[model samples]
Target: MHGTETIPVRRVRDGALDLLKWLALLSMVLDHLRYVGLSLDGLYVPGRLAFPWFCLAIAANLQRVRGAPVTGQWRYLGWLLLFSVISEVPYRLFIEDADTLNVLPTLALGLLVARGWQQKTLFDRGLALIALLLAALFSSNLMFGFFGVLLPLAMLLVFSRPWYFSVLPGLVCVAANQWQVLLDSGNLVALLGLATCLIAPLAGRVLLRYAQGASPPAMRRWAYALYPLHFLLLLLVRQIIA
Candidate 1:
């Protein structure tokens, strides 16, 4: 009991976060479908929405810890860390030429950074600093690189500020992707993908504010399994069609 704290339970459900999770999951699947032997390159644009939305959801969960115990925070980090490892095999099997690791590690590190900022404790700060340094050092090997690590921190900064300030982080989100190269290519789909990356976080913020009252399916701990399982399911589909 000396070093442990009780994690506070939420009394009300946040439909917005649930909806965002579902949307992010859908976007990810759509993006991956392009590889399942179909002409679904068009899915790329919607897929741009996935990462940003997931980042926002992470921020939202961290935001709820204001003035509360950081008890459950460890579990949150643990779950991400576990799935990050669990998801690697399936992710590699599904995405050909995936030189980088899966996206979950980035999210896990980002969570630590956000918690470090919010908690402002020595341990938290040290952990966040280490994560930041590691992300910077291995930017090429990480899924979203340094910008991905920073996105969650940016979202945390935007969470409590004026709504209009979401644009700053939105820019960071877009930069996380290859927007400049896409613009240089002058491809319509790439251009749209860039726009979606820029807009995804802003759209998620709007939903969090205006759709708070809506009742959506809650994405609980069980949802962690979805990350790896989806890849396997798609792989089966790919094998079947082949």
Candidate 2:
């Protein structure tokens, strides 16, 4: 008892955070809808908000527990790893000529990087190093790649700071979205898409910070299944309608 450490204050759950999760999920669904053969290229712009928002959620979670004891850290990483495998087939089936694994892997690695930055223990730092090495080595085959893996850390860095700090991750979000592909397209929508990516983190932070009042369904571990399930459902709908 002589050496016991004081536990930091645990923040209450924010309804706005839940709202952000739902919005991120909807953005993801909207982004995927483009593959539904609807010629909805415009959906790609709003979809740009999805990954950054998700990363922001990760940052908010880590930020909430800063200096507090981390519970279920392994379990959190386990779910991401498990779903990364589970989601791959559905992801490939939905996106033709899919060049990368599903986005969960990127999120999974990003979680490690952000966690490492937060915890800073020898073990966590080692794990973070491994996550970065994997990201660097497999950038081409991972959805969003190395930059995506870093976005969570970037968001975490600015989680408690003023809004301008969101710009750090905003640029990372754009890079992860593959700006080169957008620029090559040479369309007004493509240009707008770049702006959308650059603004997504700031917009999401604003929502998390100021938006309130609506109680959304708590997104639990069960939501991990939704990533793969959505793709399967979309594939089914595509076959039925197309």
Candidate 3:
């Protein structure tokens, strides 16, 4: 356990959280479908929902774990780091000339910061500082850059606030996407993507707050494997279509 204070000492799995994750994963797959040799640039806008929603999940998870003593936080980080490495090969193969590592690393680092904010212990806080320093130093090598690293914390800050307050993380999401050139192109999808990023946190928060009884299947750790698996599946789709 190593006393990471992450997992719930007493909380039950929230169906709402799992539903949010399912939606995030779906958005991610839609985003990656662009690589299947199709003209799905429009998917880019919805894909914009993926990262921010995922950040919200991390934030929500942190909030869920608050007040729990002596958690399996280390195990959560372990799974993220493991997948961050495992997913790299498929990620690079799928995304042509990918300049940054896959999204898991960004999520992993973001988890550190978000959990640090929630936990507030010396070790966790120190780790969070190191994570921030690393994120700043290696923003270019990260899939979503420095802004993405800060998003989970941004989400955490606004999670319990009014819906309109989501704009804080919304700005962070847009920065992570870095789509000003796309916005200049007059693409409706690009414009929609902007709108989606702006409202994703609000949507997710609403989902969790009101849809607690939705009964979605829990997205357990095994779901991590889906990130890499989907890339390979998309590659296969490209080959079939080619």
Clashing pairs in 2: none
RMSD per model, one decimal: 4.2, 3.5, 4.8
**Residue by residue across 153-220, what tens digits does model 3's lDDT show?**
99999989988998899888888877686589777887888888888888889999998998888798
In the range 170-227, model 2's lDDT, one tens digit per residue, is 9999899889999998898898989999999999988987787768888888999999
- Candidate 2 residues lying further than 4 Å off, grouped into runs, are 1-11
Evaluate all candidate structures by whole-model CA lDDT and list the values in order.
0.89, 0.90, 0.89
Which pairs, if any, clash in model 3?
none
lDDT of 1 by residue, 112-212 (tens): 88888989989999999999999999999988789999999999898878878988888988888866788898888999998888778788898888887
TM-score of 2: 0.93
- Output candidate 1 Cα RMSD: 4.2
TM-score of each: 0.94, 0.93, 0.92
The deviation in Å at residue 30 for candidate 1 is 1.0
